[model samples]
Target: MSSRPRRPAASSSGVHLLSSTRVITALVSAAQLGEDDLVIDFGAGPGTITAPLARTGSRVLAVERDARFVADLRRRFDDRPRVRVVHDDLRTVRLPRRAFAVVASIPFAVTTPLLRRLLTPGASGFSRAELVVEWGLAKRLTAARPRDLESAWWSCRFVLTVRRRVPAECFTPAPRVDAAHLAVRRRSEVDRRTSSILWAVLSAAYARPSAPARVSLQGVAPRRITHRLLGGLPAAEVPAAVWLALAQTLAADRNVIPPRGMP
Candidate 1:
């Protein structure tokens, strides 16, 4: 069996400084964090956002991989009961089993995979996430509600919103591009196997809107994939919901899946 991932050495490019007091205040207010909340500050660098988060009366776990930042965080929150320093790579740490919120000015490099860990089907105890990420990525994610070809398959599992745009100047290092506050709220649960099939089918279909929607299921009779299951709609016109419903219906019977062709 494969062991869990190990903590990684901190990357220089991954470290951008988010130390503006004004921005921090605005983010904390927007998140509505309080004493009752448990928040994970992923990529917590030098205790910038983490310090303010700790002040919000919320229980804060600051995850940092750099030894320098981890040492600083430990010293900064040494006497505080509610603030804990996790000197490990955020990607390697599994979120606590108890329900928690995420408020992080995350490293730009790890945004996608970290989101997968938080938003994938069947994950538990995830209440919400307020993230500061690249503007382009956030725009793509929220371009269409749960329908954008890339995010659509996972969209039903969470309510993701791009709240506002943040300027590059907000960070000390000043990233070449702008960033945004992306909020994600967990919604109702769907069957894990069904969710997997949905992505699998879409993964195969990665079809251009103009192309015919093709789903190649091996061994299963083509007759089983009738117009009814396909929503009687052309491939390009099919909504994410339709794809999900179709995959769910198909997944209930067997281990059938898409042929795996998407990039």
Candidate 2:
């Protein structure tokens, strides 16, 4: 008879395993997944979130970077065909080509990069996500006005909101601070063209974030139009909605051309 593989040592990769079943259930339930949905559980350490996610009847991609957890995950879900244990870095894992939802308690260390991959403009087939991220990051993402260009750009394409707080005690090796349930959904109303335009305009405006919106947006639209749309507000103070309006207006103008290299 063949012997089973020995369990590997604990990871030092900044992953805190989810120890609270109630928290796990709540997080998975919030995803509202069905069999039709395809979900990716980033940082699926020991199948904590992955198990409940599978119970939802959705196809689950349990992505883990550590070899130990990967082995454990594969063994735990071997009987469950719907759960595919992927032993790969979440940072580089291939996202689904079809529309998909994400229900995972991702690692705090790679929160920004993971979000960038999923929420960046033109990321194909990404439908929506409910992620467990650092509390500070959650607040920044859902802020009334994004603090930086990247955050603003993401806001132009998606609606980011905080669902609830996940206390630190919920994890086995509790983190220093609490986590938050950050919900991300694409802006169905905004089309590809509008998103492209927002990217161009916002990129220009944020280049000189302290400048008056009219001056910052002069390259994209006529000064008169920018002045009308933005008034005297600084580029930093301009919200995503106003930026969208500007992009939409620019998109409607036949005379105006998008900046070279714009998608």
Candidate 3:
């Protein structure tokens, strides 16, 4: 975990300043936060976003994976009763069934898993809350990264608005790529069919060693490969479970060669 003071000057302007105090204030104000909501700031580095969210009179679970950063956050918000610092892996960390919103300075790699955990079913899943995260990997889902893009798109529909081209120079060790803000409100339930389709696509793609090449063949490769590999497997109009079974079977067979899905 890295530590840096809130740059009062740099915090006031620029697109890269999404996590800055000023930007967070604006975001929260725009959100019209409910007073009782629990706002979880995932990957809270130095409590920049945490501080303002706490001011909303909402309890804030400031989750930071870094030991050093968690210590710093505790010391910073020691007096604020509303702030609770959780030092653990945000990915697997479980919380009580308390309703809350989530504000994240997300790590690009784990974004999908985190979103699924929040929106999917069961006790470990989050019920309802406003969410803010990066828009990376938000494009249409493919067989290769089905769950990845599926989760991103599922959350995207609830997005009332987005702030794009946020500058990258706002952090101490600034990231190379620009970031965007996705202001999301959780949906009641995710579409099971859509999620199923996405999983089928991705599971099949990743199973193949030449996944990148196979996925680039566009929509034709899955059908063509299914046919050639499964003795002319018919169109996938059947139940998703049946298609999933077929996809799993084909994906696990290394002997089945696939056409180039990408150039």
Ranking by TM-score: 2, 1, 3
How well does candidate 1 score on lDDT at residue 256? Answer: 66
**TM-score for each model:** 0.73, 0.91, 0.58
Question: lDDT per residue, candidate 1, 98-207, as tens digits?
Answer: 98999888888899888877876455788888889999988877654333455775565567788888899878777899999888876555556655666666655544
Candidate 3 global lDDT: 0.53
Q: What is the number of backbone collisions in each predicted candidate, taken in the order shown?
A: 0, 0, 10
Model 3 is weakest, by summed lDDT over 10 consecutive residues, at 8-17
Give per-residue CA lDDT, model 3, range 25-113, as digits (tens): 65567556667777787777667777777777888899878787788899988888888999987788786576667766666566668
Predicted model with the maximum TM-score: 2
Can you list the residue pairs that collide in candidate 3?
Answer: 15-166, 15-167, 16-166, 16-167, 143-201, 143-202, 213-261, 216-261, 216-262, 217-261
Candidates by lDDT, descending order: 2, 1, 3
Q: Please give the CA lDDT of all the candidate structures.
A: 0.71, 0.80, 0.53
Q: Lowest-lDDT window of 10 residues in candidate 2? A: 1-10
Clashing pairs in 2: none
Colliding residue pairs in candidate 1: none
